[model samples]
Target chain A: AQSVTQPDIHITVSEGASLELRCNYSYGATPYLFWYVQSPGQGLQLLLKYFSGDTLVQGIKGFEAEFKRSQSSFNLRKPSVHWSDAAEYFCAVGAESGAGSYQLTFGKGTKLSVIP
Target chain B: EPEVTQTPSHQVTQMGQEVILRCVPISNHLYFYWYRQILGQKVEFLVSFYNNEISEKSEIFDDQFSVERPDGSNFTLKIRSTKLEDSAMYFCASSEGINSPLHFGNGTRLTVT
Candidate 1:
């Protein structure tokens, strides 16, 4: 079974400051990774994903993540965060095989608070 | 910019009552999924459907939960008996293809009292 862990339950950053959200996964092989953001009372929005390619993947809103096999980690980062970027972020991992063949295992989510 | 849409943004139901949550996925999408997130918790997958059959489901999706694609544009999740624990935000998502990224609906907040 593939599981995802996000150690940070909450993150606070000032506007224009760099931010990083840590994520680690336990899987037998290379897995699919995804980052999702959700504002209060809204559905989750996909931020980025890593299937198989360059270790560093770029995503919307100037966010990116690096897949580190050695660390079993895929952390989301932003050179600078905006006030509008405040939201709850989730790290998810999916296995290649499962009854829900493409089912995603999500972390507890890190609530990001951006201060201006 | 077609996206998934869910109906009944909020529904308050009595315990032991049946509730149906509806979703209209993107026109070109093929696979459908349902997930739930309790207050202050991680999102959990409930089930996945394709070709009018259940492809996968989680343990949380027991005999009480059922999904249907009654029409080309509608996908529905029905809970037989609403338990207090079932009160959560339910999200519906769809993907264009097997490996395509999924688009999600705003979700139906089911509140059982």
Candidate 2:
């Protein structure tokens, strides 16, 4: 079984400030990682996904994440936060099951609050 | 862009009543899935369907839950008897393959009263 953890329950940042949301996963083998964002009453929008490749991957809205194999972490980062960036962010890990279907295990999520 | 679509933005059903949630996956996708998130909780996978059969399901998905592709286009999840714990935001997703990223629907908020 695989699990994901987002240590921070809520994060607050001022406009123009840098932001970082941490994520950690427990898996037996190399796993797929994804970042998703959801606003109130909305569906999740994919920020980015990492299957296998360069350790650093870029995503929409100027967000990026670095995959650290040693730490088993895929932390999302943004150099400058904007008001519109405030939303609930989830980190999920995907792995192959006995059925050979890829299933995702999501973290509790970290809520971002951007201050004007 | 092509996206997964789910009908009934919100559903209010009484306990013990059967409720069916509908979804229309992307036209060419081969895999479909159902996930739910309780208020302030992580998204939990319910089941995955492919080729009109269940490929995988979680412990949370019991006999009381069922999924079907009634029409060639419509995928549905039917709960035999609703429970208060079933109240959550149900999301449908589809993907081209196992490695492909899933495209999710806006979600149907199920409120079991």
Candidate 3:
């Protein structure tokens, strides 16, 4: 079975400050990783995804993540965060269930709060 | 850019009543899925549909739950008897291919009283 763990339950950062959210996964093979963000009363939006190739992947809103196979981690990072970037972020792993169907197993999520 | 859309932004129903959540996936997408997130839990996958049939489902999707793509544009999930535990935000998603990134809808908040 595949699972994702986000170590941080909540993180608070001031505007213009760097931010990093930790994510670790347990999978038998090379895994497909993704980052998603959800604002209050909104749907989950895909931030970025990693299937293969580059260890570091860039996403929308100036976010990026590095896939570290040695550590089983895909940590999201931003050089600077804007106030609007505050939201609940989730990390997930996509796995093939069978018959070519793919499903995502998500982490508990880390709630981000921006300080003025 | 194309995106998935889900209907009935919010639905409140009695515990024993039935409920149907509808979704219109991206026009050219071939695979569709249903996922749910409880108030403070991780998002969980319920089922996946392709070729007008269910390709996979999780344990949470049991006998009381069902899915259908009655038409080319709409996918629906039906719960015969809603339980209190079934209340959650239901999300619909679609992808162009097996390995393509999934585009998700805003989600329908279902509340069972």
Q: Give model 3's TM-score versus the native structure.
A: 0.98
RMSD of each: 1.3, 1.0, 0.7
lDDT of 3 at B14: 98
How does residue A98 of candidate 3 score in lDDT? Answer: 68
The residue pairs that clash in candidate 2, if any, are: none
**lDDT, candidate 2, B20-74, per-residue tens:** 9999999998889999999878899999998889999999999999999998899
Task: At residue A64, give the lDDT of candidate 1.
Answer: 98
Off by over 4 Å in 3: none
Best of the candidates, TM-score: 3
Clash pairs (backbone) in predicted model 3: none
Cα-based TM-score, every candidate: 0.97, 0.97, 0.98
In Å, residue B37's CA in model 3 sits off its true spot by 0.7
State, as a TM-score between 0 and 1, how close model 1 is to the true structure: 0.97
For residues B37-78, write the lDDT of model 3, one tens digit per residue: 999998999999988889999999999999999989999999
Ranking, DockQ, top scorer first: 3, 2, 1
Question: Highest DockQ, which number?
Answer: 3
For A1-116, candidate 3 gives per-residue lDDT tens digits of: 99999999999999999999999999999999999999999999999999999999999999999999999999999999999999999999999866666999999999999999
Which prediction has more favorable lDDT, 1 or 3? Answer: 3
Candidate 1: tens digits of C-alpha lDDT, residues A1-116 = 88999999999999999999999999988888999999988898999998898999999999999999999999999999999999999999976434334878999999999988
